[model samples]
Structures are given as C-alpha cells and as structure tokens.
Target: MNMKRLLTVVLAVVLSTAFVIAQEKTVDGPVITFESDSKDFGDIKQGDKVENVFKFENTGKAPLIISNVAATCGCTVPSWPKEPIAPGKKAEIKVSFNSAGKMGKQNSVVRIYSNASEPIEKVSLISNVLPK
Candidate 1:
C-alpha cells in the first residue's frame, strides 16, 4: 500500500510538470512583428491633425487576420488591412489624430485585434500640443 501511494504521488508530479511545460510552450500560430510600435510627433499646435503608419509583419507559421483596430479616444482614428496577411507578409496600419480640443501632453493608444498568437496588441502615439 505504501509503495502504491508513493508511485501515485510521483506520477501526479510528473503530470503536473508536463502540463505546466505544455502551457508555457509558444502557440503555433501567426505572430505580429512590428517595426516600431510607438510614434512621437513632438510639439504640435492645437487643432493640428497628424497621421502615421505602423508597419508590421506576420512572423509565425500561419496567416494573420486583423479584425479591427480601435482607438482609446474618438479624436483618433485607425485603419488596418481587411484581408488576411499571409505568413511572412507585411502590412500597415494608418492612424490619425485630431488635436482640436486636446491640449498639453497627448497620448493616443490604439488596440489591434487579430488572429495572432498574441490576439491583442497595442500601439501608441505621443505629442505635446501647444496653444495657438
């Protein structure tokens, strides 16, 4: 009975370890590799509009499908590719910010929803709005 109990405990430990290792393994799917995830527009006058493009590539074993891109605030807009990005292919996201009523340090965050290993990714735009 003692030997049986010891064997069961050892088996449980091995199974738990295996489970953890499997969970830690990287998912086999599309990976988004961005050239630069953030952009800085420096000092800009209020009411100015700024646009930027974020370039990224599908770096995993599968194609990447971007479903949507959302901005934290309505003053900013984002656009992304509608079609699937094949593995090893590249794409771009265009983001525009209107600093009309916004002033001082402004940080615009955009969330990208995609069918990638990391399903959600973030990019940011920063600027200091100066009064006219």
Candidate 2:
C-alpha cells in the first residue's frame, strides 16, 4: 500500500510540473522593430533632392501609436503615420533631404516619438554631396 501511495504522489508531482511548463508567457506592451535605422545616399550632387523610407513593425502585444517625427534640421523633412499601428502591422517614415546650399558629408537624424516600449527612436540619412 505504501508503494502505491508513493507512486501516485510522484505521478501527481510530475503532472503538476508539466502543466506549469506548458503555460505560455505572454509579453505585455508595444514594441517597434525597424527594418533599418539608417540609410546611406552615397555620392549625390549638390542641389539634389533625395528621400528614403524607414520601415518598422509593431512586434509586441499592444497597439503602437506614433505621435510625432522631428528632423535635425529644416533641410530634412520626415513624414510618418498619424494613427495607431496594430500589433504585427508594419509602417514607415519617409524622410526627404534637400542638399541645396549644403556641403559634403551630411548626416540627417530624425527623432521618432511614440507610445511604445521605447518611447523615442532615431533614424538617420547619410550622404556625401559633391558640388555641381
């Protein structure tokens, strides 16, 4: 009788451990994952206008809301989504750079503000400008 009771207790412990291990761990909150954070516009002529898109996805469990996008200077302009991005959805920020009256080796950074696991993110545009 003692042997059977010991066997049942061990089986119960094994089943309890298996049930706990099988439970899923859910992550709570929004996460922004960018495909690429920076783009290089190599060897461009002065007075040239260029643009690049920085694509990102919401990888977390909650919605991602992008409130604003700010550029380092007026020479660089950024446009982004104004609505909430659902989880598993993709979005982009379009940055336009004007090399007019500018010189060589420009790094334009745009700041992204949103309600995510990370509140702020950055993307940059790089170019080596040659005078016309």
Candidate 3:
C-alpha cells in the first residue's frame, strides 16, 4: 500500500511539473509580432530622408508595453507608440532614414525593448542610395 501511495505522489508531481513547463512555453508579454521583419526601400536619393511605418500586433494575453526603441546609428530615427498595446490590438513604428552624408547600400536596425517575455525585438531596414 505504501509503495502504491508513493508512486501516485510521484505521478502527481510529474504532471504538475509538466503543466508548469507547458505554460511557460507560451510568451508572457506584449508579443510584438510584426507584419514584416525587414523592409527594403529599393532605391533612394542622397540628401533625402525616407520614412516607413511598421505595423505590428499584440498577440499576447496581457498588455504590451514598449519600453524603448533604438536605432542602429544616428542617421536612423524611430518612433513607437507610447501607449500600452492591449491584446489583439495593433501599433505602429515610424522610422526615418536620413540619407545626408550617407550613400551606397545602407542597412539599419531598430531595437525594441518591451515589457514582454522576450524583452527585446529587432526590426531591420535596407536601402540603396545614389547621389541626386
């Protein structure tokens, strides 16, 4: 009888652990999934600035908070929504690529810090610039 009780307890513990692990597998925060991971401007002219808006969805169970957004260089500027994105809601990130003093194939990244389970998300932009 004692051996049977011990086996049952072990089985219960194993089941509990498995349940916890399965829950942890899902993302816990903003879940900032984007429509596209990268954008290509194709061709641009020097001395001109190009802007693109990235669309994203909050696919998590909780409110998604974008703590910060950073650019790869000073020539790239990014603007993200300041408000919390509720579950199933959408948001946008506006990026401006400055071409002054820059040419050739230009690639930049936007690092996003969020209060989500992943904590960090990266989006990239690429373009080719020629002299005007």
By lDDT, who's the top model here?
Answer: 1
Displacement of residue 22 (Cα, Å) in model 3 is: 5.7
TM-scores, all models, native as reference:
0.81, 0.79, 0.79
lDDT of 1 by residue, 1-132 (tens): 999999999999999999999888575799999999999999999999999999999998898999999999999999999999998899999999999999999999999999998899999999999998
Model 2 scores worst on lDDT over the 10 consecutive residues at: 21-30
lDDT tens digits by residue: candidate 3, 4-85: 9999999999999999998876666568889987899988999888888999999998999898999989999999989999
lDDT of 2 by residue, 1-132 (tens): 999999999999999999998896555888889999999989999999999999999999999999899999999999999989999999999999999998889999999998887899999999999999
Candidate 1 clashes: the total is 0
Off by over 4 Å in 2: 1-27
In candidate 2, list every pair of residues with a backbone clash.
Answer: none
What's each prediction's clash count? 0, 0, 0
Q: What are the RMSD figures for all models against the true structure? A: 3.8, 6.1, 4.8
Q: Estimate every model's Cα lDDT from 0 to 1.
A: 0.95, 0.94, 0.90
